[model samples]
Target: MADIKHFDPDAALETTLRLFWRQGPEATGIQDVVSATGLSRSSLYATFGGKHDLYLAALQRYVEQRSEPTFQRLAEDERGLLAIADFFSELVTARCTGPFARWGCMVANAHAATQNLTAQNADTQVRAILDRHHQQLCQALTQALTTARSLGQLAPGTTPRSTAEVLALLAYGINLRSRNGADAHALNQTMQTALNALTPSRR
Candidate 1:
């Protein structure tokens, strides 16, 4: 009988998520996963099914484990707009200074690059996933903006829903720019530009 090994699904999935984040779906191979998780081919197959399934698993893990904190910081924490601003500021700081700055965000990279499938089925699935993530971020931003409005931090007459959409787009843009090797100063300037739009003009 073959030796059955113990595995922690969450930890294994976390490793897989990091691998996929560092390298996109197409670029990551079974051997890479095996190496990262110390799982043999048979174990991986028996446990996770296949590469795509594993990719989906890793994505779910990423959404739950990684995205929740950011969502909380941006949405649940109530410094109104300041929390969002500081989040972006920290993003800028990290991108400019973090050791693995070049890796960028896996979720954003996947959405940006996954739309090129030639087959109809492949195209549909990939596009659906991308759209879903985009809407999720949009909703998160909407919540933050709504909270800011409730707290009177927003400039007068600013609509929470509309501003949220714009801010979500700004956040996406900043992530993309960082992936493109934009520096801290550049990101700071972008943040400033975005904030300026939200700031109320005095009479």
Candidate 2:
């Protein structure tokens, strides 16, 4: 017979993801996971392997649960630049307020943390996830920009692919800054400046 587990692994993983998102992987120890999940070290190890393994699981969960849906919406939306504007607006609101306030993006935080790690210590799995995230975000933005150009909303000489790259980096910047307590107003202003540069003149 298979061994029965007493705790909800999904629930525990959600809690673990939030813990890692808020405290980061380096600062969060197994004890912290134990305290946060109310699980024994033995159970955690049995279910999730070790700290590194758990952190990787949490990162995957974060991307699946939080990031992918948002990217999917942006990629499918037909409103062009307006969709992109709404995307940034919602991003700022989520980052600066609510239960998730100040937690930053899990992926962005991981990217920042990786910079401090020696090449030998860097996790290729983590890099892969981050790379996939960047590609997805850019693809969504590129789709939106393509729609915008079709509708004559794009400024003359602006290219969808190049603009998508800029906006992808900008999104990362907002994530990092918001984690550092940058206000919603500042983020919105910066987003607007970028959007305005992409907008066509009415005259």
Candidate 3:
């Protein structure tokens, strides 16, 4: 007789996502997934394949739910430098105070664990996530800075592509720092100081 499966895989994945988000795959083991998902080891293996597969799914979910919408909004926004500033400001606020507080970004966190991940699939997925994040930031900054330049918001000799690269690195830095429990105020101040260099001489 075929045994009926009683667990919700979607619900299980959500639980898995939270666990992986908090501790990351390097520290989180198969037993931790079983514990967090309330599933038997066999059930997890049968349903999700393995921890790496489960993490890949969870990472895709994170990008779809957490990153894509925000990037889209920021990219389309006409607020230029204010949009960029607001992006970092919101990141600090959410990272420090929200329900997902201290979770950092799964994509950014993945970079640190790349040296330890053995699976090619895991490496590919992590690289894809990072690349998508970089391209999105570049797109948003390009849109915003095009406007900033038109409005004289950028200083003379400002280069949009190079500046966006710097800001993207800043975004990744904030994600890692917030995961370590950095103060939101200090993070925001750090972000503002970075942005100040791009400001017009008047500000």
Question: Tens digits of per-residue lDDT for model 1 on 127-185?
Answer: 66667666776776777777777887667888877777787677767777887888778
Give the per-residue lDDT digits (tens) of candidate 3, residues 102-180. Answer: 9898878887778798878778877887788779878777777777888788999998888988888998999999999
TM-score, predicted candidate 2 vs. hidden true structure: 0.96
Q: Could you tally the backbone clashes for each prediction?
A: 0, 0, 0
Answer with 1 or 3, whichever has the higher TM-score: 3
Best by lDDT: 2
RMSD after Cα superposition, model 2: 1.3
Give me the runs in candidate 3 sitting further than 4 Å from their true place: 1-5
Residue 176, candidate 1: C-alpha displacement in angstroms: 1.9
Estimated TM-score for each candidate:
0.85, 0.96, 0.91
User: Distance from true position, residue 37, model 2, in Å?
Assistant: 0.4
Q: How do all the candidates rank in terms of lDDT, highest first?
A: 2, 3, 1
Where model 2 places Cα greater than 4 Å from the true spot, the runs are 118-122
lDDT, candidate 2, at 183: 89
lDDT of 3 at 121: 76
Error of 1 at 195 (Å): 1.3
- Lowest summed lDDT over 10 consecutive residues: which window, candidate 2? 114-123
Best by the TM-score measure: 2
